[model samples]
Target: MNLYPFRCSLALMAMVGAVISCSKQTTDPMEMTSLPGDTVLNVNYESGTLSSGVTGISSTHASAVDANYMVQPGAKGSYAIAHKVVYGDTAYYSDGAYRSESDAVALPAARFAPGDERRYEFSVLLKDWTPWLSGAIHETNIFQLKVSGNSTTGSGVPLQVRVARNALRLRYADNIRVYNFLADVRPYINQWIHFRIDAKWTLDATGYIRTYMKLPGHSFTIVDEKTNYATFAGNPAVGNIGYIKWGIYGIQEGLTRIAYHDDIRIIRLN
Candidate 1:
């Protein structure tokens, strides 16, 4: 008998509930915060330029070498650095994009001592893998941490992350270490992968370098952990400063390799 009035009351209640629900929705943006601890270099490459103030020098060539290296759109953001090393490219065997600083960040002889730890994190995507030949060596340095000496000799650690003919390889000093983390990584081509290096620079038996890698849809797995690694010679007179250079280096003859990188971070953990 009073069904009309009951329906009207129900509609009014529904309208009030709608208004309350709408009011609860927030239009304000979320705030962003930096990660805890000290950061020496944090480059996301969103600026579309290699000169992001993390280092004083960004280069495609160390000594008149020429390769295609530029900041383009990337996986994690709107910008990423792409490096292309083609066979017969002019300049030294060293070719690709790199940012360098002298004794800055965690590379100083004073900053990274025995028991001091530093973390280097970055993401890499292998856009194109160089073709492989039977029994041939296809080694390229994708990331490098070099300890520069006085104009005569240069020594440091280099990550041969891309070895086209076989699995990934890492070259530190005269030693070559291979990893199956990306064994037959051809299937993961064009997919972003994560790489990390936690280094404790020292001359004695206490020194170590722990390497971690994360494939898509997977957590970071330790690829290698080496103790007494020759990351740096104890003699400060040889070189007290170090620098980081990432991008395709040591391009093999007759092969063209391309890769993209983003979110490079260097942190000092005291």
Candidate 2:
């Protein structure tokens, strides 16, 4: 005879349970604090420009709007940096390679000095990609950890994240030593692929670089890592410093490539 009050109690209990479920889904601790640290650079491209600790933008022959590189809506938040490269657009050159990149450079002062341990996290989306299924497009670098000042003289870049053979490749070359890692990425096209690089910039054998990757709706997995290896080239005493540059580089083939980058954070580990 008083079932109305009982029904009201049931409704209230349902609401409380729903609220708790929503709270648990929304406030995921792992998602929020997956990589917490002293952030030296945090850029989401939400400002529609290069923000945070970005020193400058380097693009080859970027005359028109969003030519080689521009901040646009795509990767993360409301905007991300778009890097584009077409065939025969190779006026700019660096490290003895023809480049068509819209690279974001982290100048010398913002670079990781010797004995620095840092975590570099970023997300990349391939809006349009010409796979390396055929032709002279053997490989293309999407990111680089370059050596500056007196450090090594070979590639001038110790670490490189590249796209090759329809796969994601990680290459490490310091002086005469070289290492490689590969993961097939054909099924992951047009989807966001997140990467994290924890590295110790050292000239000695005490340095290491561990790379992790995360797919959508999945946890991060360690794709590759190098230990007891040198992470930098040359000598710091001669003015060697290591810096990061991300964009599309080494597109020798006659195909158009477009990629988006966002949510880049460089955390000082030590």
Candidate 3:
């Protein structure tokens, strides 16, 4: 809402010798890898890598109605942009297509497009209830949202108010658990539990240059598990790859339930 996020949280606990520095503006080649036990990040995962836009670049998902996963009015619709799923009964689309529900499951705000060095990979599968606003649901096999928007959400930008590169999180609250907001890092229902996330942001001129992320399963260790490197600090004027985003996010009364996201892969992180 104010967008001043330069909270390097301490650069992941810096001063160890100070190798942690980010404001994003680069020449590319600041590689730092580690996160492979079993992969699922697509776009062409030989092992992992991509980067090439400005061309016919295209990718999208998230859209449903009479089946479940509502919210498709006008800011526009398409399930938030493209990429959605949540089934214990229904709300899917990895190719299964089972859209048709209405007991009450509203979530808007999460359109997709992560340009720049683009290598976005997200994973889902949650069931956090226990104090997660209530507690004892446990379907969290893994969860992730490794980002790297670098910049641009339209308007003067600055909605979630914090983008020293990209980490704009607007939550419905719960640093961890207790109604588990901010999408609960990637939570809502908790059953189909199986998520994936791989990120890559590399722009420059002061916005980003290197934002690599890898989402491994069973990694739902809990507590935002280091909110994406938990080391903000990267804002080279900000600007990476963007186009569509809304993911309205939900939660507020009735605690929580109904969350599923499947096989979403945006690539360019070669």
Query: Which candidate number maximizes lDDT?
Result: 2
Candidate 1: residue 101 lDDT (0-100): 16
List model 2 lDDT by residue over 47-104, tens digit each. Answer: 6764433556454444434444445564667877777766565444445554545444
Which scores higher on lDDT, 2 or 3? 2
Q: Clashing residue pairs, candidate 2?
A: 151-234, 152-233, 152-234
Candidate 3 per-residue C-alpha lDDT over 77-101 given as tens digits, one digit per residue, 9 for 90 to 100: 1221212334433333322432211
Instruction: Give the higher-TM-score candidate: 2 or 3.
Output: 2
Off by over 4 Å in 2: 1-37, 50-65, 69-74, 90-109, 149-155, 174-182
Clashing pairs in 1: 65-91
Model 1 lDDT per residue over 1-270, tens place: 669999999999999999987655422111112347577677777766655445553645434323434546676788877766656645434423321111133434323544567777778887767456576575666676655453355444434355546566666654556554455777767888888887877656676777788789987778877776555543455555555666776555666677777887777755
Q: Residue 254 in candidate 3 has what lDDT?
A: 35
Q: State candidate 3's TM-score.
A: 0.23
- List all candidate RMSDs to the true structure: 9.1, 5.6, 19.3
- 1 against 3, candidate with superior lDDT: 1
Q: How accurate is candidate 3 locally (lDDT)?
A: 0.27
